[model samples]
Every structure is written in structure tokens, then in C-alpha cells.
Target: MLQSYNFALSVVLLNVIGPSLSNCSVNMALGMWQKLQIFLAFVQSCSNPFDIVCPHKSHVQFRTQVHCNSTRPQYMCLYDENKKQYTEVCVEEAETQREGYNTILRGGIDGVPCSTNNYQPFSHSSNTGGSCAIVKTSCNDEGQLLYDDGSSTTDRSCRCDYRVGYDYVTVPSNKCFCKPAIEDCSCYMKYCDVNQVLTQDYKCARVYKLTGIFDCPEVSGLGSKDIEKNKKMPSNATKTGIFFVQIDYYQNKDKTYHGILDLILGIAIGMIIASVVLLSTADILNVVRLKYSHNDVIHIVCNHVETVVLCSIELKCHLESTRHCKFIYWTKRINGDISTITSRTPGIHGSTVTYPSLTLDSPLIEDCGEYVCCAVYDYGRVCSPPIRLTVTGDVPSFSVDNELHNTDIGKPVSLFCKIYANPPCSNVVWKKYEDGQYTTIHSDSIDCSQTKYFTFTLNLDTFMESDSGYYFCYATNIVGTSKSKCITLSERKYAPTIEVDVDDNYCFNKINEDVSMPYTVSANPPCTSVVWKKKGDGTSTTIYSEKIASSPSKHITRSFKLVNLKEKQSGEYFCVATNEVGTTKSQSVLLYVAEAEDDDFSSDENRSTVTTLPHRRTRYHSCPSNWETDYYPIKRRSRLLS
Candidate 1:
């Protein structure tokens, strides 16, 4: 069996790899010792046929000449047909004795050597110098044999003492025999019991049979009495002269040996076909060398610049190609319009195309915008993502002065500083310095565009004394911060106040007579300068410096006089006063220079006698004549001209 298994293995290996090694001398290269080892392995695997047929008996010897080998010491007289003589052999080997008696039973019955109808009782004799007699055997109630002739024998025949692998059966002649038990008899019995024994009419009987053999027939209704017949036999003792009943067993058609082999072959063939297909597919794909074709990608980096920036755009193609490609750098405006960049364009080199840099010698705020790089190939044109270019600088210049500003109370004023920056100013703060301390007046974020300059203005709703201080404008951006020149702002303490006094609405003076208009000036600080002007014809005449007075009092009064009465001097007259804070003008008064009327009745000699018109005159005073006497009695004050 082992040799057959090895041969089958060799056949499978040859079927798999024989064609590849057909030209090789592998068999001739094997050593003699290896070949001898293989031959010895085959010889050792061969089985002895006698051991398989009669495993426990020594009668069938391979090398010995002994005729009978039995445990029984008794001798039996027998005839040997092969020897043609009456030979004395062991009781186990003798077939028959005289008087028609068989010492060795065949088929569990006593028989003569040559007689066809010889049936005699079986017996055994001891070799202890005693006469041999017929060994009496009796049957128990169950018809099992109980030997009373043996010295160590008991009458307990009802006990089934058979070996585990043997069973007792009753033959047709009412004789018992021990036989090897059938394996899986219950399964075979089930098959027959379902088909033949178990009828549709419900009549059934238990059956026993030996399956997978040719000679055994089915036996039915074998009871426990038959099983008890072989109970006394040893476990390893050989059973003979008994035939096992053959059962017509059922087999599953789907699980036959051929079906199992076909299933395995189908699986193996499918796996081989799958492996071949996979390898073929891999080879075909490797030969074809398929790949994806992609367009060129453009990259543009905007160089940061303080004064001048050199900007470049680069194009890279993922695939190698011999075709000519063109690259164009574009600039996008804030209004969403694209324009090609033609100046300073570079040439292409292999898979990369680098555009010549644009040099901004003095990049201004206008140089900042969105730029894009594009690659134009034979297939299509691809553009890079838009990038914003920013040309930033320090905070742009602004101008301011340290001049002082005086604003009146209850007036609105604005202090502003102009700032210019490239990226625009982010924050603006207005600070004030008062009493050696600085304070933030206002702070706010300013979004100044690149094209526009920002003006930070601090508004004062009502000017007050607290608003007087040194103010500055602080501007900041990404580059740096700057502060405007400080300017001092102060609230005007007093506005120039002027008052004009005249006796009448107009100045009435005869020819060659003079008329005077008095004006009062009041201010916190004394007036720095004063002017007197005529209202009519918008003429300003200079007043004599001696007429002006710097007064210690808060109010100062001055009078303007006409030396000669003239029609031009009769026009309206007013006084203007100015101080460090502001200027003010007094009310205008009309001065009339009149001509004297002549008498008709009298001659030049009688002109005196004629009615003389009252001397027309005008009086002007800064104070009442009564108050002048009460306040300045010690000094003679100027009185009204009457």
C-alpha cells in the first residue's frame, strides 16, 4: 500500500514538472546509496499475506516446518491425504479418528475424513496417563453449550462471554459458531429494515448483516441466546466456521469516491485557470505601460519689495513632450479684467518655463495687484491660482506745524493730519498734551486704500479751556508708525469788544468846523492795533498814532476828529480793534459837513445883523459828563463838545 502511495505521488509530480526537466539527467545523477535506500523502503513496505489472513494463529508459517502448533498437549491419530499415511499429529491438526469420530471439528461439527455424511460428537482427552473418553457436552436452557467434562468449567452458559469483535450465530442445523462481528451492522440493518423489513402494513423484524462482503447473507430474529453461545471464548481467539449475513446497504449518491475526486479536480483546475489569468493580465498591463496625461501647472511667486521688486512666474509640466509650449504671465485688475504680460518674458527650457522677472525700480502703491501665470501647451492652457502682489513701504509722509491756534468759545474746529501709506494705515490716534501729561483724545481704525491718502481729523464740538493743549496725530500701518508734528491749540479767552459813541446819528459841522466820534475798546488783553475807516466808498484812512492810547483798564476810549469839514469827511466813520485773540469793529457813525446859509436882506456889512444860524455841532463822549465829575473829579476829563 505504501509503495502504491509513493508511486501515485511520483506520477503527480511528473505530471506537474516533467516537461520542464525532460532534457535533464536528474535520475543518472542520483548516488547508488540513494537508489538502494529507495529500494529498501519499498521492500519494507510490503505486507505479509499470512499475517493478514490468520493474525493470531502460528500454523501458517513463513519459514518453519512444524506441522501443528497448538496449546493442547493431547495426541490424535489422523490420516494425511498429502502424505498418504496414518500420521500422529496434534489434536488441533487431526481431522478424524477411528470409529467415525473427528477430533478436530470443522464448521463447528464433527465429521469423518472421507465419509460425506459423517456427523459425530466432538471430544478432547488429557495426556495425564488416563484413558480418553467422550467429553459430554450439554445445552443450557438457552441452547448454549455447557461443557461438564472439563475440570475448570462452570455451568454458567447463559452469560454471553464472547470477544468484543466476535458474535455467536446459530446455523440452519441448530448448531452454533463464533464469527467476527460485522462493523457498522446497525447502519446496514437500518437500510434493510427501512426497505424490506419495515413494510407499509407496519409488520417489521430486526435484521443483522455483514456489509461490503460477497458471501454474507442477511439474518433475521437472532436472539440473545445465540449471542450467549460464544460468551466463553477468549477476546483474541480466532473465530471460524461462521458466515456473516450480508446486508444490502444503501449509499449516498452525492458523496461517492468518484464525486469527491471530481470536486477536488474541479477546484484545482479553477485555481490554476485563475492564476494564469492573473499573471497574463499583469504581463499585458506591464507591456502596455498606460499612464495619465496631465496638463502643465503654473506657479507664480510675488517677491516682497521695499523699494524695488523682481517678480517671476514659473511653469512646470508633469509629462515629457517634444511639442513646443508657450507661457504667458497675466495681471488681473481689481475690476476683474485680465491682460497678458509681454515685457520681460523668458524662454521655455524642457518641461519648465520661467518667465523673465518684472523689475519695479521704484514700486509704488499702484504696483500692487493680483497676478496670474499661465502655460499654453498644444492641448490646452492652464493658469496658476491668482496671487496678490503687495508693495509696502513705511508710513507715508505727513506735514504739520508747531503753530498755535486760537478758537473762540462755542465754536467748532477740526484738527486734521494727512497720511499716505502703501498698504494703508490701520490705526489713527489723536493725543493731547496738557499740563505735562499726555491723553488720548480719540482713537479709531482707518481703512485707507492704496490709492487714497487718509486724513485723521479730531473734531471739537465746542471749544473750551480744557481743549487747549499740544495735539498730535499718530498713524500706523504694517511697515511702521509715524507721528505728526505737535500743534498747540488754545481757547480764545476774550473777543475784541468795541463801542462807538456820538451825540447824533450824523456829524453836523459848519464849514471849517471839526466833528469827533469816540470809540470804546475792551478786551482781555489790550488791543494790539486799531484802525479807523470811513463807511462810504470803503476807504480806510490812517489815524494819527498820537490819537491811539494803550490803556491800563479793560476799556479804552479813543476819538477820531476831522480837521476840516468836507463832503468826503462827512461819510460814515467806524473804529476797528484787534488783539491777540481776535478783531472787532464798532458801529459806524455818519459825519455830515454842512455849508452856512447867507442872509438876503443885509449886505456884507450887515451880515452880522442878519439872523445867524445856530452853530450846528456834534458831541461825542466815552462817559457822561455827570459821571466824569463823580469818578474823575481830581483830573479834568474830556467833556462832550456842545
Candidate 2:
């Protein structure tokens, strides 16, 4: 009965724990497969298996779990084929557990132990095997699950599976995803309407596929009115179905931001263009103005003494004709008063106007003022600057110092004329009186402020007798003219000519007897000194020197006297005349002084008588019969002769 009870107990234990043990083994195998897949994924992501054992904080809760508890038997059942009986035996529990755990850990299964969680039954008849339980769940809105048979993970884990031309992105918590990629949307067309010109500011050539969000590029160069009218246009993409639409845009090439250098270049170009336009306009205006304007007036002068003077005004007009032109004359006084001159003769022809003579039969002092001439034409009038006129009562009054001037040869001399006039002398002229007429020598206008006197000079470098003449000056003004008295010029005296008168046979007694010799001297100016000189033995001695009386004809005769005739006075005698210019000597006359000659003094008929001649006559003396009467002629001599 006890044997029967033990066998029944063993059968019951097997029946109760068999299915549980199989399920546990299946769960463990599935867990190990899942862990292998996780290890492969981790190696692909981080390239290291150690990271899976120690994951980051974001993945710590999802790490794989490994089972470490052993599943082994402490006893075993043995079978005996010859006796056809089965027996039970004891085994090493610790050694058996250690060998079973090592085998499982090494991924090998040698034998099934009597533990429920370590073993499962195999059926060779069916292809289906035990697997882990699966539950059906839904994915998030943005993702879908990959179908495997008809089951999926019960933990609600899904992959991002999107349609064609679409993609997804997960949220920060990784529990949700988004499908932001869009296709076949025309957001660029909505922003830039059909009427809007496609420029660089509103270009849309590329398509956009955003991940997390949908944004469009900015559009520009649209007017405020256009924008307001197009307010109903869509600015953002629509989020529908499994995708969100996006549009991309580009900036306009023409309307772009400019740097400082570009801005400065633009401004400089604008200024240059404006300046060119202005200069062209100014040139045109100047050409037009020059075509109509008249030329300037030339300066003119007129004399004051004239009774009538033509007022001629010339106008140079560049136009074709000047048919309507007239001239007007005006006069102004020194006191700053102006008056229009109406009395004028009119003769206008083309650009020239010759007004009648301004007649003044009896012009007063008031008429001597400034005069001006003006031309009046159709376009404008041009006037010349005023000119002055002067009037006086009479010519200048002048006087000279002397009527004659005596100067030596090769000397300089000046003639002066002191003028006094009511309005001062305008001109002073020096003239030379020659050949019964006067010839101009020098002329100049005197300045009244400096002096009213005028002087003229004569330079005598090569003195000649012909230079001796009359010189006079004339002073002139507006009213009349006056002349100074004529002046004469005389040169210094020249050397004189001398002539001696003596008898050839006039003998004088060597005693207290008186004798005289007469000499005639002729010079330009009378002789100032006359001397009696004796020449003998190759020498000359002056016997007498005295001032001689002059004659009106510049010729004089003087007697050279000897108080007593002596033997020493028997030499040749001559007379000399001297003045400032030169000296002159007469021819020598031989004289004989002896004792009373026997034959000449005994004769009563040959008595020596001194006969005086007239003022310019030659003296005569008589000779005796026995005395010699050889005549010696009186010689005429000049200073210029040898």
C-alpha cells in the first residue's frame, strides 16, 4: 500500500508542473532573442556593446533584462532493461545546479532537469511552436506600425512609417512624431500673383520639404495697395492628410541692399549728369544774348577853341540791321549838374551817328564843362563817358631875361622864358631865327603845378662861328599865344692881326732924343694889351706893355715910344697884341742908332723932322743926299700865321 501511494504522488507532481515549466522556458528563449536584437541595434548606433549594459538616462528604463537563477534537479530516475524495472537515485544538488547553469549561460542545453521553469516538451508532429503572447495597439497620429502576421508589440512601440514624398520627425519625449514634408503644393504662386512681375525680389524656383514645420520665404517690391488688395491670399502652407506644404523664395536682383561705396557712386553719377545739363543750358543762353548785344564805345578827345565840333558816336551792332537808331547829346558841369543838349545837327546812318556841330559863337566860362554822347536804338541805349573842355581869356604872357648872350666857343648855354597866363600855358616852343625866318628848335607842354617857366638849351660840342644866332620862345593856351623877345649869342674874341709902319733909312742920334713906332691891331674884340718887343741875337725882349685904347671897328693903332735912342736900341723891333683868345705879333723893322752922322747932320736941307700923320695914316721921314735910302716895307701879320 505505501509503494502504491509514492508512485501516485510522483505522477501527480508531473501532471501539475509540466505545462508551467514549458511556458517558462519559452518565455526565457524569447527574451534572449530580443536581447540579441537589442545588442545588434546598440552596436550599430554606438559601435560598442558596453554602452547597452550602461545606457544613458534617456534609455535607462528600456535596457534589456537577463535572467540569472539556475534551473537544475537534485535527484534522477534510472531504468534497468534486463529486469524490466525502474529505480530512483540520489544526485549532487550543488554540482548538478552549477553544471546546468553553466550550460544555459553558454547557450547550450544538454539535459532537462526535474525543475518546472527549466524545461519544455517538444512535439514532432506539428510545425507551430510556442511563442510569447502578443497584444494589438495603435500608433501615434504621425506614425504607423510595421505588420507582422496579425500581431504587434503590446507596449505600443511603433516606427515612423510615412507615405511617398513624406517624412516624419519625433517630439522631444519620443512618444509622438510629425509628418511635416509636403508635395504638389503651390504656395509660391499664392504669394506672387499672376499679375505681379517675376523679379529678383519675388522669385520662387526651388521646392521645399521641411521636417518639423512649414515656413515660406519673404516677398518684397509689392506696393501697399497691391498688398491690401491681395490680403486674401494664403501666406502659410496647409497642414492636411499626412503632410504639411512648404514654399521657398529668393530675393530680387534689382532691389537689394546697397553698401556705402555703392551709394556714394550712385550720388556722384547723378551730380555729374545734372551738371552737364546745366552747362549746356547756360551755353545756349549765352549764345542767344551775344547775338543781340551791341559793342562797347571807344574813348575820344576834342579841342576847346573850336566854334563847332561834330559829336560822332559809333555803334557796333551784331544784328542784320539798325534802321531805328538815334543819338542824344548831354553836357555836365564841374559842379555835378547835368543837362540835355538839344541844339545838335542830326545825321544818322546805320551804326554811326554824327550829330550837327555843337556851335558856340560866344562860349562863356559855363560852357566849358564835360560832354557826353549817347546812342538810342530799338533794343537799348549806350552812352560814352564824359569828356572835359577848357576855355581861357587870352594867350600866356612871357618874358626873357636878356636880348643877347655872349658865350665862349665849346660851351653850353640855356635860354629861359617865364610865362604868366590866366589858365596856364598849355605849350611852350623854342625857335631859332635863321635866314630871315624862325625854325622850331624844341617844344614841350609845361605842367602848371610844378612851374610856369620853360627853358631850352644849346649844346656846342663842335663850336662854329655859324652857331651865333637869335633864339626865342613862344607860349600858347586855348585863347591866344605869346612870344618872348629874341636873344643873341656871341662867342669870345679871336686872335688879332697887326701891321707896323717904319722907314727903311731913319737913323736916330745916340743922345737924349725921342722916337716912336706905330702899330695897328685888328681883332673881333679890341685888343686888351699891346707890347713892343725887340728881336736880336736869336732872342726877344719886351720893351713896353700897356693897355691900348680900343676902336669902334675892332681895330686900334698905338705908338710904342722910346725916351732916348741909344746904341743898344739898334736891334729889330715889333709890336704884339694880346687878348683872352690869343696873341699876335707884327713884322720886325730894323732900326739904326748912331752918333750924329757927319754928312746927314751937317746938311741943313737933311735936318731930321718927325712928321705926324692922320689918325690912321703912316708917318714919313726924309733922308740926306749922302745917307742911304734903302726902303723896308711894313709887313702885315696875323696870330694864325707862323
Candidate 3:
């Protein structure tokens, strides 16, 4: 009867919990244990005084207390075929006794919350051959209770934001988001609204899921204002979203800025007005100065230091409305060279020497030195400051019209030698070559300051053949000496005037023995020298040199004594006179020497005949063209009849 009662009890508990079980495959195994509390609650409500209460059932309360006190065992059991249905003993041993505890093993469906009429509390399984699981339920004001399947710890209370491709969302909870296919859609505040339209299940890998719902506020001016929020979208993106932005407003200006602008305009206008006034006033003042003032000094500017020859230093005067003036006489002093500045020579120092009412040309300073050009005006003499002249030797300068040419011989020729030097020079000399020799003629040094081009003509009289060759004029000062190329003069040919007739005895003597005669001849302007040569042989000798007389025609004589003479010397004697200027030869003179007569022959053969004298031959030589007439012609003697 106890076994039959236990079987009936299992069947009843199974029936109570069967319907409450969830559809989960694991919950089916819960059987009657799933709804034990609900069944008990029903039992208490249905009990009558006349019904029989099982003794085992009365221990349900005590057994429940004991099960609660023991640590729940985590184990699984299966049928062991070798030991045919492992004994119920193992199950009884695992269980502990509790006062009024009653449990039966069975299979049954678990009771659900909706069917429990809200009377059920917390419960575990109460059926035999089934495992017990805990089920908890919560209730609402409608007296309805909702039960958890007891399989999971989570609830359906939370919701996530839904979005599609490339959605922007925050991390962790991932509450904020931006709409997909949009540019610059990063969340600035909360959730972006357009982002919610996308599907949530379609999320990207390595991307945070929007697990929270957030609302975005409406931006009033975005896409609504005249200006577009964005221009271009990224290549992969389709649209750009406008975001809420905060901005501060400002405006400013001041009175100082307006005042400055006014000041600038006033200054500009004043300047324009001042310019017009000054223009008219300056014209009138200039006229007044030109008419009333004599000290209207004008400045001059020079340009082109080298290669600048004749340049006009322009002269100008400011002509007031009342006055007019003309250029007067002008002069310039350049490095001691004096010259009148005129239009012929327009300018010298690259430009004209300019002055008020007096503009004049300038002179050239051939060398580097200090030069000044003094202008003489109608009022007075106004001198310019010493202008330093530094001329490059790249283009050398020459003093114009300062040389003399076309000179005559024997007469003095003066070469005007001038040069441009800074400080005045005193010493001047004339240098020349004369008779294969050099001669320097000195002149008295003279002061030269007032002249711009200091020059002196050299006087070279008493000239000789050597002196006639080439003449040079040199001028020197403290600075240096300047040399001019030689001015050539050919020696003039003139008849040699016989000024000397020495050796009169030699001129009129008869030649009888071997004799040597030595003589001299002199002439003017001055004889270079005297020479003698044998008529037949080319032998010649020098007799006199560089000898001269006071006057060109004065007679100066030289004497020659002969010791021995031969037939060659006895033939004819003549004298020649010559000078570097010219030469003249004297007429040939015939000299007679008695020849020894042939002696008569004495007796023949007995005594040797003796000759009385040796025979002598006579010869004659003519004088050359270097001397005057110094000999008489020979007169033939008449033969005596014997």
C-alpha cells in the first residue's frame, strides 16, 4: 500500500508542474520538481477534515529545511546497464530527513506564472526521477506575475540603438552615434537622430555597438539657413550631417579711427593747396631775387671724369617775373693754366663751369691735380673751389696748340712747351742733339701760377749740325718734368767762308824731298771739324774739330810746318775750308822741284863712268770742295837756246 501511494503521489506532482515548464529542451528534464510549491499551495487549499494525510507527505516541511541546509551537489546521473537500474537505495542515501518532509520522484511539466493565480512563491522540483531547478517571479499591479525560465540571469529591460553601415557610436555602452553614409558625422552631444534609421543587427566587426538610445536636438539653422553646412562629402560617404554648434557674437569701432582718417585727408588736401601756393609764390620770389639781388649764385655739376673734352658748364639765373639777364665775360683758372671760358670751348671738367648769368666751357687738366675755374661776372669775380681732378691714364691728354714747327737752320727756333700741372713749375729747359752729342740748354726759372697752361718757347740760336738734328722742349716743376718729342731741323747747306788761312809757307813752297805738311781750315756757322786726305791714296787724317769764330765771315787762320816731302807730296799743294754748315775747296797749286840733270859720260872702258843724280818724277793733286782758293796756277818756263 505504501509503494502504491508513493506512485500515486509522483503522478500527482508531475501533473502539477508539467504545464509551467519552458520550451527549452533542458527544462523538460525538470519534471515535477519545477512546480512543487504551486502544487503544495493547491493541496492546502483543497484539504478536508475527512481526507487521509500520508505520513511521508507530512515530512515535506522538515525535508525541505534539511535540503536547504546542505550544500547543493553539482552532479549528473545516468542508468548503469551493468547494475540494472542502480538501486533506489543510492537516491535515499543522498537525501536527508526533515520534519514533515514529503517528496516523490516523477516526470512532469513545470507550472507557468500565468496559470499559478499569483499565489505561487519561489520553488524547486518536487517529482521523483527529475532534477529540481529554482524559478523566481515578479508581479505587477494587475495581480499578474511574470516568471523567469530560471535558465538565464538577464532580463529584457535594456534596448540598443539601431544603425547600418559605417555608423558612428560611442564606446562601452555606445550611446552616441552618427548616421551612416554621412561625412563628419561624429557625435558632438548625444545620439544623432538620423543614425537610428539604420538596422542594428548589421554591425561592423571591431566597431562598438550602440546599446543605448540617445536623442539629438534639432539645429535650427542647419540646411535651413542661406549657407550650406558642408560642401563636399568623402569619396565613400554619401551625405553630410549638420551638427549643433555654439558661437559667441561680437562688434566694435571707435572715434580715434575716424579722427585719424580725417587727419590724413586734411593733410593731403593741405599739401595739395600748399603746393599750388608755393608754385605761384616761388615764381614771384625768383623774379624778385633775379632782379634785385646780385648774389644769385648757381651751382654747377660735372660728369664723365675721363674722355670728357669740351663740355659746357651751363649758366642759369632764376628769372623772376620782373627781371632778365644775359651771360657776361667769363674766365677759368685750372691747375695754374689761365684761360677765358667761352662757347668755343664749351666745357672742360665733363661739364660747363656754370654760374648765374654766366655759364662757360671748361679746360682739360691733362693730369691728376687740383684745379679751379674762376668765373668773372658783371657784378664781380667769383672763384670756384679747387676741384680735385683725378684723371685715369687710360686716356692720356695733350696740350693743344703748344708746339712750334717749320723752323729755319742757323736761326733760333722756339718751341712753345706747355703742360698742365697742379702746383706751378719754375725750371724749364731745352734738350737737343748736336754733332753726334747731346746738349741741354737751361732757361731761367719763372713763376707760373696765373696761367692754366704754363708754357715757354725755347730759344736755340748758335746752332750746329748736331744741334740741328732734333730739339726737345722740357718743363719741370716740383711734381715732375714733361718731355716733348724732338722737333727736327735739317742742317742748311751754305758756301763755306774761308775764315782761316794758316801754313802760308806750305801753300807757296817747292817740293824737293819727302815732306809731310800739316795745315788747318776754318769756316762758319762753326766747322764740325777739319780733315785731310792724300789725293791718290785713300789715306785721310783729322786736323781740326768743333772750332768756330766770333763772326760767320771773320778770318781765322791755322799754320802747318812740313819737315820732309816726297814726290807724292811735292806734286801739287792745296787747302780746303769747311764747316758743319758747308765746305769750300781752294784752287790746286803747282809745285816745281828741279830734277837732277844727267851727267856727261867720262873716258870709256878704262875708268867706270859715274852718274851725277837720281831721277825724280812729278805728280799733281787737286784740292777737295771743303776750302777757299789757297793756291796759284803754275806758269810754264821758256826753253833757253844753247
Sorted on lDDT, highest at the top, how do the candidates line up? 1, 2, 3
Compared with the true structure, what per-residue lDDT tens digits does model 1 show for residues 471-500? 988777665678888878886568679876
Q: In candidate 2, what are the lDDT values of residues 462-565, reduced to their tens digit?
A: 55567788887777765667887877877756798987655563434444354566657888777788777778678887666677565555776656555445
Residue 396, model 1: lDDT of 52
The residue pairs that clash in candidate 2, if any, are 21-116, 200-251, 200-252, 200-253, 201-252, 345-356
TM value for model 3? 0.22
> How does candidate 2 fare on TM-score?
0.29
Report residue 299 deviation for candidate 2 (angstroms): 17
Would you give me the overall lDDT of model 3?
0.35
* Number of backbone-clashing residue pairs for each candidate, in the order shown: 6, 6, 62
lDDT accuracy of residue 544 in candidate 2:
64
**Per-residue lDDT over 1-642 for candidate 3, one digit per residue giving the tens place of the 0 to 100 score:** 212222333333233222222334214333322343234334334533222221133444454454433353322132233453321212222432121222332231222221111122224333222222211122111111122222222221111222212223333232232211122222211232321222233232111132222243211110111111122212111110111111111111445643564465456435533543343454445546554564534333442233223233333322222123232233333444433433344332222223223433432435334333333233222343343444322121125353335433456755565666544445556677777866887765666644446666666665544544666766554445676666665544455554323233223222333223434444435555443322434543322233334445423554332323333334444556666556776544344333333243234342223433346232222112233333211211111000
- The CA lDDT at 288 in model 2 is 54
